[model samples]
Target: MTVLVSAAIDEDVEFERVWLDDASWVDVARGWLVGPDAVHSALLDRARWRQNKLWRYDHWVEEPRMGAPARHGFGEPLHPVIPKLHRALEHRFGVALSGPGVALYRDGNDGVAFHRDRDLRWLDDTLIAIVSLGQRRPWHLRPGANRFAHDLQNKGATHDISPASGDLLVMGGRCQVGWEHSVPHVRHPIGPRISLQWRWTSRRGHPVRGPSYRAPRNFSR
Candidate 1:
């Protein structure tokens, strides 16, 4: 297990930006690309061939209400560059990540419905890092009301994140607790987008699954 530090942000624009100049609450952070483009290109090349699964609507044990299009992972021993980014995130947050990271790709109008990533044991009220590559898309987040109301409500505090090639978004603490996030389907043609979601889990092994479906042990509301 390797320990890493976090990077410092010199500008506020890197932290918060309002969409449409509205103050409803759409916060985003973008990290600068540090190395050669070749590294990212290579990773994308390999990811295209990796196995992925489409999350079935009926199979998910929890939060079966929304869509879980596709999901995949990058196994043990992350790429060499990942540790450096992990270290920078740790330094920025003043805490260390507790487990291995995974990468997922969503394409063809596929997306994750409204939900939160708040079940990891190692997470313990910390942040999860998401890096976007390839094409840009809109990522939305809103407040979670009652179960019945949440399923019906589409307008809450929302953030439309248009992450360009090689951009990073970190959601933590209150952000994950009070809000639910999703990447809705786009009507226009969009190229495949790869997201590297860095998270900490207590489990030791990784299992392959469909694009939308996660392993039963890892599934939660």
Candidate 2:
């Protein structure tokens, strides 16, 4: 039997923060996870994956990418690295976070459209941390239409940050409300990429509603 191990985070790991308008910012940390190839392989081989269907045009259509089996409730078993990463994030960001919501983008064909996270209880002042594994892919971000209408009209620059294997990217400070993001499809062939995400919000106890990117079972009418 092979024992799975997750390397401890390096204390000296540095992150570059790019501030967007409306107090939104993105933090990128290159080469954060150690031996990401092994991690990606482990997830691909061991974890159960599912295809989610979305209610599109006239009927339900299968989602572009595959998702991990939903683990509802607490104390469920997770990857060895999940808890360690969660603790590190909470300690570093000074906020309590919940999750290891896993997403797998298999090849360039699998991508998500730009959208703000509406499922959270509070969109503003929230933070989401993601650790990327496997091939490099562009994570595109642009100003929200509600806040930066002029920028969009003027063809404002879209920020494209590619998180390679073992990289970490975080978005915070009104990002969900002030900006939109997506993983756009590409023509070139690319390997699978797995993202383990953790999220935090200071405004708690508010009723959580809206279409969640993770909840594909829900329909949009």
Candidate 3:
């Protein structure tokens, strides 16, 4: 049997629906990358050895958190196919990204809670590109109000994106600031899924500090 594949498009030209009237959330833009299946498989293979994290909230009154691995700088070469895909998005949105590609693996009950990617040290007002691969799941986006209130009154809409084998999601502008997003766990049996998130950071040339490196003792203490 022959499998039908869909094409990816840039955000500007793709069909979109606003989730929250007050936020910059949009949905239903299909395949925005080389191919979701191809990228998904690649990320799954890479993540087999790489570690993953559970998202956390720092404070009681903090916003919902989505844990992600530290950004991996571009000093390491990216898969050749990724550059072409990245460039396509950059041209579409007219924004240049920096370095460190992020890949996420959600298996079993693993899921990402509602949140935004605005707090990165190097992140500015730029678009964050995401390519989805594997089993289809729901991605939710909502306005960022008081944590409690937002979680309560925020009937924030959701997009049950069935991003089959290959699909992409590009979020930008006030989207990051005005809204929060997430990939909730599904009850259906889902095979391993991989998502590649591309973004640029301002802190490129910074040095690395090992875990053993201790801070200087505070004499005042």
Best model number under lDDT: 2
Report the backbone clash tally of model 1.
23
| lDDT digits (tens) for residues 1-221 of candidate 3 | 22324434344546565444553545445755545665555444433334433223332222222223322234322234555666776776666765335545455476666666644432234466676667776766655663346455324544445464456666654565556777776677767665656664334333233221112222242
- Give the runs in model 1 whose Cα sits over 4 Å from its true position: 1-13, 17-27, 34-39, 48-79, 98-100, 121-124, 146-157, 200-221
Off by over 4 Å in 2: 1-6, 70-78, 146-157, 204-221
Model 1 agreement with the true structure over 1-221: per-residue lDDT tens digits: 22322233323336663432221233356644444233345455443344444345445333311222122244422345655666766786677674334444446466667766645533324466776656688777766653246444454534567676556676665444456778776778876666666664333233222332253444546
Task: List CA RMSD, all candidates.
Answer: 9.2, 4.1, 8.2
Question: 49-101, model 2: which lDDT tens digit per residue?
Answer: 89988765457788898888424236444456667778888988998988778
- Candidate closer to the true structure by TM-score (higher is better), 2 or 3: 2
Worst 10 residues of 2 by lDDT: 148-157
- Give residue 31's lDDT in candidate 2 (0 to 100): 81
In model 1, which range of ten residues has the least summed lDDT? Answer: 63-72
Provide the global lDDT of candidate 2 against the true structure.
0.77
Total backbone collisions, model 2: 0
Q: List the residue pairs that clash in candidate 3.
A: 8-31, 36-166, 55-67, 72-100, 98-200, 122-202
TM for candidate 1 is 0.61
